[model samples]
Target: MSFLFNTYALARPALFSLDAESAHELTLKSLQKAYDCSLTRGMMASRPELPASLMGLALRNPVGLAAGLDKNGAHIDALGNLGFGFVEVGTVTPLAQPGNPKPRMFRLPQKQALINRLGFNNLGLQAFIANVRKSQWRERGGILGLNIGKNAVTPIERAIDDYLLGLEGVYPHADYITVNISSPNTQNLRTLQGQDELTQLLQPLQEKRKALADRHGRHVPMAVKIAPDLSTGQVDIIADLLPRYGIDGVIATNTTLSRDAVKGLAHGEEAGGLSGPPVHELSLQVIARLREQLGASYPIIGVGGIVSGRQAKEKIDAGANAIQLYTGLIYRGPALIAECVQALKR
Candidate 1:
């Protein structure tokens, strides 16, 4: 086992004893602490090869730390040490808004799942970008994908304004930008996934990207993150529109509103997106559906419920080009990243 895995194993019990959100905060704090102390500096510098080339960006491996884990990009340098091929941070909006009240995040240990309605709570794009620029990881070739969203108070009609602002703010810092329109927590956010709305949203962004690409002399690709709750028809519509809109990639899913697998469990009825093991098969189905529609060459970053090495390989085998993690880190900690990298390399 890797040294980091052993360390996390020792702390796992205590972490599990705390409230889910509290444990999450504590974990992020510890990562920042280790980073500040320079204790993890040389840890994964000799990482074994798990090469991936996605959307014109080079990645050391196919395992990525999903956006919500490092919401404000505050821990990229620390997370980078955990050995992710890429670390995507944020669901940042044009303006910062305190998300749904506390107790917003819940853990369902029995199902090895979690339900959260954090509502895109983040440090806003400016602070998010500042945090990204402060990190040395990107300069050292670490891949960073910034996930952008609209603020809760923003009217649905004006959502594009926020995303456009986020694209502008994060374009230079991000190797790729993810236009997040699938989070169930934000009011009306998921509605943007509809055909007419998606076209309207993506078209403007594409135009802006063209201008940004010219101005910066860099083309930072954009990926659209979708929801697992989508019908096969919805997924197909998205698949057809992606390449047409000039979207660079697609993240197979965000968390789901479906509680099919976690029914009868505590917190099962909680009003939030469900993630972890329960969503595994559902996400895989989305990938299969998306791959059928998107065809082989389009990049698909699979996320939601990827908890082990076997599942990691299973996702790729099911047609995902790469895999990302969030809740799994909470359950298995740093070890999960190494396990996934090892699995994919096989």
Candidate 2:
């Protein structure tokens, strides 16, 4: 563990020197290399195995890598080596996209956070599924989630078409599917969260999932990813609607648009969702409220601003059935996974 921690510490300087997205690409490539060289086991020699389950899927542990980290499912095998119970990839659309623009990702070292408006840039559905099929992680019993989204060119009214296509394409390959309607980067994406729009979106997806389950002879659970920037009423409305629509779970609190926490910091006013410690409290609040409305049995994967084991545990305390990490991994490295698992064990 110390070796891995020290290794990342030594490498952080060089990686940080590059632009954020470039550093991200480099990190993924490096992980793939390390896995190919069979060195990840040494780095993660003591990964704890605290078996658990969520949304009917068995997990080795409840710590998962959230979506957006491996957008195209490109590094599932390599990332699975780091000891995540599950790894979710994509926000992939029905068609390929170049995303927003360069410099869409920013790092705020002083706050140990990142801001990204990458806008679901991905290699489209076919390429995404091909990459997922190439991965051996799921074959090795690692839970894999494929998060689906609509294309930028698709109008909000026609968004369901994109999601339905995404769902059908990814259903057989996924241990679970995440319906991502929360990213602030896409124009008016969050508008789908409205009461009527959400119902329209979920009904057809659930119906499609039912047909796919029968066709594939498997029942794959679907979870909705929601933003943290919602009102109490909004959260309550969603909670009431989810079970009614036959949705299996909810990933509470995607990145936040509020800059209240990072105000006056460099790049604080940037036009994108802010993630890291700044959104931690906001995420916890949403999880707590969702739990109040959804009850103990509903699965809630809490994410946002977890930078420590204590914060990871806090998500559970706030009523998350499981938790995911993204921004924290950027600041704390793989050690944070073991740390979070240990914290959960207690």
Candidate 3:
């Protein structure tokens, strides 16, 4: 653990100095190399027991590396060894995009948060599928979910088409599929959350899910990833709609737009969504509210502001079946995975 911290500390200054987007690319490249050499796998394998089950898939643990860290299906094998019970890849769209302009992602070290309007930049479906096909991780077998989304240019009314396109491309490979409708970066994307719009969008997708399950001879559960900024009314609406569509799970609280927790930080005013320590309370609130509305049996995957084992446990106690991390991993490093796994055991 000290070695991991020291190495990252030495490298972090150089990486942090680069533009955030470039730094992310470099990080992914480094992980890819570590994976090719089997270094990351060896490092992660020394961790304590990390096993759990949800949505009919057995996970090595409940602590998963969230999507957006691996926008495309690039580093699954490398990340898998980092002690994550699962790895969610892609907010892949039907069409590839460059996303928002540079200086789009910013780090607030003091606040232990990140603010980014990355806008789902990805290699399109074809490139994404090619990348997934090249991965050696898929054969290793564990819970791998693909988070799907519509293109930036696609209208909300026709959003289902793009989701369908993404589903078709990723369904065969993903253990489950996540329908992303909450990103604040994309224009009008959140409108799909409306009752009428949600039903229209999900009904067709649910039918498609059934067809895909029959065709593939596997039951691929579909989970919905929602934003953290929702009002109580909106949360109730989603809880009401999820079961009607046969949705398998919900990933509560994507990045938040609120700056209440990180009020005085240097990058606090950045326009993108805020994620990390500041988001913990609101995220937990959403989880608790959803649990009440959806009933205790509904599966929920908690995310946002989970920086420690106790925080992760709070989400679980609030009714999350599993939890994922992005900002926490950024601030805490790989050792956090083992720490959370061990802490959960106690």
Candidate 4:
């Protein structure tokens, strides 16, 4: 922790000077190098593991690394060493695809936000599972959640095939599975949230999961990720249906398409999902609404725009059992994780 704060403070200026995507790629590569060579293993943060129970999975803490930061599961070990109670990787489609074109990611420092349309880009299901197999997080007792999505080329109606494929491939490895039906970057991907579409998408997956659990002798939980742009009625509809489908949890949001928060900031006009400070309140509203309808019986993984411990606590106050981070990590670094843990544990 001391090493990261000191070094990252010095290196942030240089990293921020590069394009967002390039900087991200460089960091991932560097983390991989450091972990493989044992350079960062010693520098990793050490904290009292604040054990928590959510959706039947026992976790070390409530703060988790959200999906999208590691689209391919390549950084599982490296990220796990940084002290997340859990790490979720991907939105990995059944097949590999290039995703949206470059310049698809942009940073708005002024608003503490990022906009991206990196449409489920990754090395596909097989590669993703292989990476997860190589990770040490599971051995260390860290919960690993694999998020699955449809490929850009897959038709909306046939999207179930991709998700089902992901379910079968990752079931043996994941601590939990995230069905990502909310990323706005993929065309009509958000449409899966609609009543009939969502039901159709989840029914088959849950049925298969029952068989998989019986075969593997492990019943891994499944969570659905949704967008923040939905209306109250729409959110209610989804909440009402979660229990019927046997979905174990719901991530309050993926990202928002609304520009209201970053209206005057640079890159606010970009045509993609927006995340960071601007999304904090929007995501909270969704969690609060879900909590109101579902009560404490269901679990909600709150995410979007949490950049500090206080902010993480706010999400819990709004009714999230656990919180995940992504955009905040870019702005605040590893320190945010401890801060969140402290706030939540207290």
Which residue runs does candidate 1 get wrong by more than 4 Å?
A: 43-46
Name every residue pair that clashes in candidate 4.
none
lDDT-best of 2 and 4: 2
Please say which candidate is ahead in lDDT: 3 or 4.
4
How far in Å is the alpha carbon of 259 misplaced in model 3? Answer: 1.6
- Per residue, candidate 1 scores C-alpha lDDT tens digits across 1-346 of 3667777888989988998889999988987887677546555333546888988788899899888988888888888877789989998998888899989899998877899999988878788888988998889888989999999999999999988898998888888999999999999999999999999999999999999999999898999999989998999999999999999899978999988888898889999999998888988999999889888899999998988999999899989999999988888877888788888877
Candidate lDDT values, in order: 0.88, 0.93, 0.85, 0.90
Using all chains and alpha carbons, the TM-scores for the candidates as numbered come to 0.97, 0.98, 0.96, 0.98
Tens-digit lDDT track of model 3 for 140-184: 765788999989898877899999999988998888899999998
The prediction achieving the highest lDDT against the true structure is 2
lDDT of 1 at 194: 96
Cα displacement (angstroms), candidate 2, residue 116, comes to 0.6
Candidate 3 ranges with C-alpha deviation above 4 Å: 39-41, 44-47
- Candidates ranked by TM-score: 2, 4, 1, 3
Candidate 1, run of 10 with poorest lDDT: 39-48
TM-score, candidate 1, is 0.97
> Distance from true position, residue 272, model 3, in Å?
1.2
Q: How would you encode candidate 4's per-residue C-alpha lDDT over 130-234 as one tens digit per residue?
A: 999988889978899999998898899999999999999999999999999999999999999999999998899999999999999999999999999999999
Return model 2's CA RMSD, one decimal: 1.0
Worst 10 residues of 2 by lDDT: 38-47
Q: Per-residue CA lDDT of candidate 2, range 41-152, in tens?
A: 5665445688988999999999999999999999998888888999999989999999997889999989899999999999999999999999999999899999999999
Q: Candidate 4, 135: how far from true, in Å?
A: 0.9
RMSD of each: 1.3, 1.0, 1.5, 1.0
